[model samples]
Target: MKGIHQSSMAVRSFVVMACVVIILAGIKTASPIVVPFVLSAFLAVICNPVITLMCRYKLPKWLAIILLMGFIVLMSLWLTSLVGSSINEFSKQMPVYRAQLVEQFAWILDKLQQFNIHISRQKVLEYFDPGMALSMTTNMLSGVGNVMANLFLIILTIVFMLLESNDLSKKAHLALDDPEMRLKQIDRFLQSVNQYMMIKTLVSIATAIIVGIGLSIIGVDYALLWAVIAFLFNYIPNIGSIIAAIPAVLLAFVQFGPAAAGVTAGLYLGTNMVMGNVIEPKFMGRGLGLSTLVVFLSLIFWGWLLGSVGMLLSVPLTMVVKIGLESSQSGMWLAILLADNVDDKLSDSSMENHKQDDTEQISEQEK
Candidate 1:
C-alpha cells in the first residue's frame, strides 16, 4: 500500500510538470498578444496609486484617470521627440564611430607592443570588437523602440484596467469558494507587487537623472540617450546597469579617448553602487529580495519567452510567481528556494501555524 501510494504521488507530480510545460508553450506561442497586455497591467499598477489619491481628494475617478493619461501622453511625446532624434543621429554616426574605434585599437596595440606586451591586434579586435558592441547596443535600444510602437494599445488597455480596479475584489469575492481567505491572499499579492514597482521605479528615475547629469558634465555625446537606457534597464536588476553602461563607455572611448571612458564607467559604477546597494536596500528591505541566481535565470527565461520587454519585466514577473507560490501551502517550499534568504525555522513555524489553524477549523466543524 505504501509503495502504491508513492507511485500515485509520482504520477501526480509528472502530470503537474507536463501541464506546466504545456502552459508555458502556449504562453510562448501567444507572446505577441500577451506582451502588450502584460505591459499594460504593469503600467496600470503603477498608475493606480495616483488615481486612488485623487479620488480620496473628492475628484471623480474619470477625471483622475484623464489627468493621469494626459500626463503620460505628454511625457511619451517628449521622450519620443528627444530620445528618438538622438537615436537617429547616433545611428547615422555609427560608421564614423567604428572607424575611430579601429584607430584607437591600433594605437593601443602599438603602445602595448612598445611595452613588450606582444598581444595580437587581430585577435584583440576579433574578440573585443568595438563595432560588435556598438551594433549590439543599437539593437537593444531598437528593440525597446519597437515596443513603443504599441504604445496606444498599451495605454488603452491600462485605461480599461484602472476602470475595473475597484471591482476586482468584488469579482474575486463572487468567484471564489472561500472569498475572505482568497481575497486576503490576493490583497497580499497586489500589495507586494505595488510596493516593489513603486520603489523600483523611483530608484530607476534617480539613477537616470544622476547618470544623465554626470555624462553631460563629462561632455559625452548622447548623454540623454544613455541616461534613458539606464532608466529602462535598471528594472532588470543584477546586470542591467552593466549593460546600460556599455554603449556610453564605448562612445566615450571612441570620442574622447580612454581617460574619458574610465570616468564614464566610474560614473555608472558609483551611481549603481549607491542606489542599488544603499538606497534600494534601505527602502526595499529584505523581504522582497530574490536570490542572485533566480534574478539571472529569470532574465534569460523571460527574455527568451517574451523578448526585450520580457527582460525588462523579468524581476517583477518572477516576484509575481514567487509571491503566488508563497501564498500556497503546498508551494511554500518552492518560494523558499527562490527567496534571497532561506529560513528553515520560519518555514517550519509557518507550517505549524497553518496546521494548527486547520486542526481548529476541523474540530469546530465536527462540534
Candidate 2:
C-alpha cells in the first residue's frame, strides 16, 4: 500500500509539471495581455503589508492606496525616462555598436574559414541567433511593435493591482467556503511572496550599486545601463549574475580591450560571490532553500512562461506555488522543491531565550 501511494504521488507530480509546461507554452501566445496583470498581482502581494501599515496610522483607505499607487507611478515614470534617454544615446551610437559587433563576429568567421569549416557566418547566425541573446531584456527594442503596448499594459496592471488589493483578501475568503483553509493558504503564500520580494530587492540594489561603481571606475561605457541590467537579472538565482556580466565584459573589451574585460568579469564575479554566497544566505537563513537544479530549472521554466520578467520573478513564483501546495496535504512537494538537509533557522525570540539560558548556566558554573 505504501509503494502504491508513492506511485500515485509520482504520477501526480508528473501531471502537475506537465500542466505547467503546457501553460507556459500558451503564455508565449498570450503574454502581451497576461504579463502585466501577473506582474501587477505580484507587486500588490509584496506591497499589501505596507498598505496595511498605513491604515494603522489612521490614513483613509482610499488615501493610502492612492499614496502608494502614486509613488509607484512616479517611480515608473522616472525609470522609463532613464531607459528612454539611454536608448536614445544607444541609437545615436548604434552604427558604432553594429560595426564593432560585425568586427567581433568577423574574427570568429575568419578562424572558421581558416580551419576549412563548411559553416557560413549566415548559417551560424540562422542557427544560433544572437538577436534574442543580445537584446537581453526583450525583443521590444528590435523594431518590434509591442514595446508601447507592453509599457502601457504594465502601468495599467499596476494601477489595477493597487486598486484591487484591499478587496483581495475578502474575495479569497468568499471564494473558498472553508475560511480556515483559505486563510492558511493565503497567509503562507503571502509570507513566501513578501519574503522573496523583500530579500530579492535588497540583493538587487546591492548588486546594482556595486556593479555600477566598479564599472564607472573602470571607464566602461554606459555603466548605469549595465547596472540596471545587473539589478534586473539579480532576481534570477545562481546563473543570473553570470548572465548580467556578459554585456559589461563586452563593453569593457570594446573600450579597453582584454585586460579591462578581465577586471570587469572579476568585479562582477566577486560582487556576486560576496552577496549571493555570504550576505543573502545570512538574511535568507535557509528559507526557500531550493535545490541548485531546481533553481536553474525554475529559471528556464519561468523565463519561458513570462520572458525576462518571468526569469526575475521565477524563484518567488515557485516559492508561492510551493507554499500553496504545502499548505494543504502536499507538504512533501515543498520538501521536494527545497534543498535536502536545509536547516530551519530558529526564530529570533527562540534564539534570544537560548542565549539567556546559556548566560545563566555560565554564571552558575563560575559560582
Q: How accurate is candidate 1 locally (lDDT)?
A: 0.83
Best by TM-score: 1
Q: What's the number of clashes in each of the models?
A: 0, 0
Which lDDT tens digits does candidate 1 get at residues 117-149?
887756765666555765676676666667778
Cα lDDT of model 2 by residue, 136-241, tens digit = 6434222112333465566566667766776766765665454644345465556656777888788899899999999999998778877877887788777778
Looking at model 2, report the run of 10 residues with the lowest lDDT sum.
140-149
What is the lDDT for 242 in model 1? 93
**Clashing pairs for predicted structure model 2, backbone only:** none
Q: Estimated TM-score per prediction? A: 0.89, 0.70
Off by over 4 Å in 2: 1-29, 53-58, 94-133, 137-178, 181-186, 328-367
Question: Model 1, residue 198: displacement in angstroms?
Answer: 0.9
